[model samples]
Target: MKVLVTGANGLLATNIIAVLLQRDYSVIGLLRNEKSFALEPHENLILHKGDITKVDSYDALLPEIDCIIHAAALTGQDIIDYSVYQEVNATATENLYKSALEHNVKNFIYISTANCFGFGSLDDLGNEEKPIRFPFSNSLYAKSKLEGQEKLLRLAKDNPDTKLVTLNPTFMIGSYDTKPSSGRLVLSAYNKRVLFYPPGGKSFINVIDAAEAVVNSIELGVHCESYILCGENLSYKEFYQKVTKQLNQKSSYVKIPKFLLYGIGYIGNLLRFFKVKTDISLTNVQTLCINNFYSNKKAQEKLKLQQRSIDNGISDAIKWFKLN
Candidate 1:
């Protein structure tokens, strides 16, 4: 099978491409620049330079492509504009699906965020069926991803022949994070004497496990269905301790009060009003204070996703960060 993966230089896409090559599948990686790609050259891998939102850039390659893993996304809490998010996350996704249909691409896998679903407490974890909740609902990034997921599912209903599977992964951490996207979380407390963290916690998954689930979705996933690819749920304090332990460093963990976080968020809002781009906001801080936990039972059952210890992910990220 020949697969086309967008955001070829991204953390998740890098790992996904590696898995595809290991499984003996031909891959065409679509990204803006070939020079910034993270993966090493392989016989089955081909890098194609292109813009994800512009379908015309790689429209000709769609004919021979068997599957497309749409992993490219405009993420971050810093962007203040909804239009920017919509253009990349929502509009581009719908356009790609339409083009894939025209070109006879049978399998389309979309990598979305777990924030699309409502988060729950440790006792009751969130699942694919839950509706999105506050903070995340107010988040432009999450809202945009949900829009993309809805559009794909709606389009799939009319076209039964195409297999449209959406995988919503939680906070992912592992190696090959060239941009050091989520690896920033791991670096935050590494070798630190004191670690200040938010009171809330969320679901986390190893990138390798998330990549494997994406590949399994091609054969095992049901049409128009969504899966939450997640793993252990740990509070910020607990997670920081794990990081400290993995790095073999001693650190004191401090939990920032919700009030203080909200105060900082207000300052962030003021900065944004003055045309300054900042990630600290009321909604973003609120997201940090809640238990944004989720369940991986659906993915484990259907996609055969294995829940590896987050410790391994932490270790791998630390090793990669130190080297690169």
Candidate 2:
């Protein structure tokens, strides 16, 4: 089948594209630029240059594609421009699903986040039936993704020919992530920059496993249903120790108080008046390091997913980080 993958240049998207190619599916990538990290170069892959949020951008490309995997979104926990995410995360999805209905695409896989579900304990494995909306629903990125999911579900309900499935992953760490995002924090531990550790820990999964779940959902998932793609959880101390072991070295360590981090966020918000460019925006870091663990049983059963141990993910990630 011919599949059109949005955000073809992202870390996760690159991995997803690799899996699809390995499975011998005809893959078409929608990319805004050739230089994007999500971009894949292959003979079976057809790369189209276009903006997903623009009607004129992907309009022609949608007709011949059999499935659509939406993975493009703002990368950070912080809100860059709320409007930009609204268009890319929420609106672009609206356009894609509408076009899927018009063109009769068989399946649509949407990549959502477990962040939509507030931070939970290891025991709190949320399923598709559980409601993620709670007091923490006020956050910008989560709210936008939830809005997009709702919009897609509405489309799925009304349209029989179009199939929609969304995958919610927790704390993805893997290769091809050139950007120094949350996963890279683990890498930073080895580099000696992460001398201190955060208080809260989270569920971890290999990016390859995350990509596999997305492909499996496209191949066999029930229409209009969403599943949480998650794995093992740990405290920051445990996570750090795993990293330190693989590095085979010792580094200074401290437990960063959450309140202080929040204070920094508070100060950053106040400093927003001065206009800051750093990613450590009061809003971003605080929201990210917030402790949370989610369940993956739903994805394990539905996607027949297999997850690598967190140790392996860390070792592999650190090796890649150092080699690069």
Candidate 3:
């Protein structure tokens, strides 16, 4: 079967493409930029230059595919405008689904964010059935993603022939991150740049394991269902400790107060108002304040999903980062 993967140049998409090739499936990678070192040369792998936001660019590629893995999205970066988030994450997804419907695609797999279900603590874990706390999301990226999820689920309910499955993965770790998008935390720690750690915790999984969950969903996944693919939950301090121990670094990270972080965020907003480039945005600080814990029980039972230790994930990520 031929599977078309959008955002083929991204971290998760690169990993997913590798797994698809291993499963003996013909793969077409829909990437906006030119293929980088992230992609390996393979006989079965075909790279198509297309933009997910522009539906007209990829309309021809839809008919030649048996399945569509819509992994493309705007994530892990500070957004200056809300419209960009809506265009890339929400509106683009709706357009792709419309084309998939018109082309009679068999299976449609969407990779969504676990944060859609909102913040979760140790006591209250986010799950598939839980409703999203939309008001809590300060970032346009999260809001747009939630919008995309709702629209896609509605499409799944309306269309019976085309099977639509959404996989909401938690914070991802592991390799092949040329942009170093999801693996930014690990990269920062390894480089001794992570001095202050946030107090909030999050559920995390290895990227390879996350990829397997997506591949398994191709066959074992039930139609019109949303699966949360998560792994062990750990706080920012705890995660930093693991990285320090694994890398054998003597430096320790200090727990920065949330209030101070918010202050920095407010400063970032001021800089933005003046048209200055800033890394630390208010949305970034807001996200770091939330304890985004989630449960993977449903996926474990149904998709046979299994997550390895966080140590293994971190170690692998460090190795890949050092090499590339």
* TM-score between model 1 and native: 0.99
Which segments of model 1 are wrong by more than 4 Å?
none
lDDT of 1 by residue, 9-120 (tens): 9989999999999999999999987887877899999999899889897799999999999999998779999999999999999999999999989999999999999999
RMSD score of candidate 2 (Å): 2.3
Candidate 3 on 209-279: residue-level lDDT in tens?
89999999999888888899999888888888888888898665788898999999899989878877656
Q: Per-prediction TM-score, please?
A: 0.99, 0.91, 0.94
> Alpha-carbon error at 203 in model 3, in Å?
1.2
lDDT of 1 at 169: 98
TM-score: model 3 vs. ground truth: 0.94
Q: Ten consecutive residues with minimal summed lDDT in candidate 2?
A: 276-285
> By TM-score, how accurate is candidate 2?
0.91
Specify the poorest-scoring 10-residue window by lDDT in model 3: 131-140
How would you encode candidate 2's per-residue C-alpha lDDT over 204-257 as one tens digit per residue? 788889999899887779988888887778877787887888888787678888
Best by TM-score: 1
